[model samples]
Target chain A: MTGALIAGIAAGLLAAVLHFAFVQSYILLGEQYETGELVHFQTPADHATEDHAAADQHDHGSHEHGDEPSVLQRNALTVGFTVLLYVAYGMLLTAGFAIASQFGRKITATEGALWGLAGFVAFQMAPGMGLAPELPGSAAADLTARQIWWWSTVVATGGGLALLAYGRSILTVVAGIVLLALPHVIGAPLLDAYYGYAPTEVGAIFSSRVLGVGLAVWVVLGWLAGRQWDRGAAA
Target chain B: MTTTTQTKTQSLLAPILGMAVIGLTVLLAVGHAQSATLHDAAHDMRHATGFPCH
Candidate 1:
């Protein structure tokens, strides 16, 4: 529907705004630590200045770079990519909404907030339990392995939640529960040895804030999409 | 639902699949693609949104 498209665009812009306001600074700080500008866990006895002690054993596959990108200069790319991300989320959200509506389940603007939370659960919370947000220079499991786990977890959680939300019979609900639990049971791939350039303190803050921002943005997205869908229904 | 609503929407399958494919592509490109250019281009968002990043 045009409603969902408009909603998606609106939500994407809002999400980017929220990201700029609340999330960008921490990313900048993490990058500083990532590039040897700041050091963490240093003690006076072994205070090693000018030592790239945190030499970024980070295995960012295919992230080789000849020169570092200038910080704060590429606002256009950041905003553009973020909008694209949320637009995608919006499309997916409304697609689910349309299917539910077709099945005789009507969605309201208020109910859409719940859908947003569900989206967060499926997309952000579920996968996050396995792979907490990471900072630059932080050690992570293999790229391909983690991606596979993350994508699977999102699909499983979304499908499971959908069943629980829409299912009437016990059997369907039970199947939903199974899908929800499958990924966590398998566990996310993690690094065997942990080494990182960023401080644990910064990492901790950044991770939680990412989730927090995700929650807010997703709720708004759902609400906007739902409102538009409802308007179409009323018309 | 109104008659207008019914007329405006078609079989749900087509739209659902269409949107799902497009949305997934955008998400994958922004969040998971392995290209160095994409990673650099989306560095802030990649980190801010909790997608797995270096």
Candidate 2:
């Protein structure tokens, strides 16, 4: 029991860290497209029909946001909730592995990585081409929507295949996909008036690359998590 | 020794099943009672936590 708890904590931390890495990479890539003028920034400011005040307010707040929380921040509450999310996700995976192991099956970190890849291909890659939401930061970029979709699909499928080729299996792959999709299925308007139209190929491509990188990060994280869980059980 | 092994096994299974039951019950009740509200909150939480799925 002690071992399980320790393992759970370790897995949670590792996954969280990996998630941070993916976010940073996506952010950086987005900056590249913006600064390079590869994509035009389209804002409500550019359109006379939209509310400039709302757009300006949004931009100002985002640009001025601090890395550290304010004194009035619910730091403890945030940490507690974050920890709960991580531990719960970890526990679910660990339990799944444990159950699988009882069936004379063995899963390794590599297998976990493959599962992560599948998640990218199915949830991020496939949907991203047409279904994923574009980031506000990339709103003004000049890339076409179809281009973005295609690129995203290529990255997702290709990256997933690369991960699977390294000796992974079906279970983790499927689990990762399910994990990626669950929150989406449960939240946000499925059909938002904001992104009603299909994305251009360029937009899809850009989104795919970003998502591919994210998938890679997730695969590594999941593998590390699984390895840590196994170590805890043995210890 | 056999009885001891059985007791240990029972102890482990007990908590696992208990927690699972609790989780499932809450999940089902939430699903039936206020799915939209639950979804909205979960979505907001996921975004705040920087979950990449969205």
Candidate topping DockQ = 1
For residues A1-106, what per-residue lDDT tens digits would candidate 1 score against the true structure? 6776787778778878887666666666666677776667668644553233223212121223447554335667888888888888888888888878878888
Q: Global lDDT of each model?
A: 0.81, 0.43
Instruction: Compose the digit string of candidate 1's lDDT tens values, residues B1-54.
Output: 788676656655687889888888989999999899999898778888878876
lDDT of 2 by residue, A1-235 (tens): 3333444455445444543433323332333344442234456454332223223322342322366343124323333333445444344344545545544456677765555455445434555534453532334222344334433443455444434443267865765455444534543323323331222543354355456544654465457556765565566
Enumerate the candidates' DockQ scores in order: 0.66, 0.15
Among residues 3 or more apart in sequence or in different chains, the pairs in candidate 1 whose N, CA or C atoms overlap within 3 Å are: none
Which regions of candidate 1 deviate over 4 angstroms?
A43-72, B1-10
Candidate 2 reaches a DockQ of 0.15
Considering summed lDDT, which 10 consecutive residues are worst modelled in model 1 chain A?
A53-62
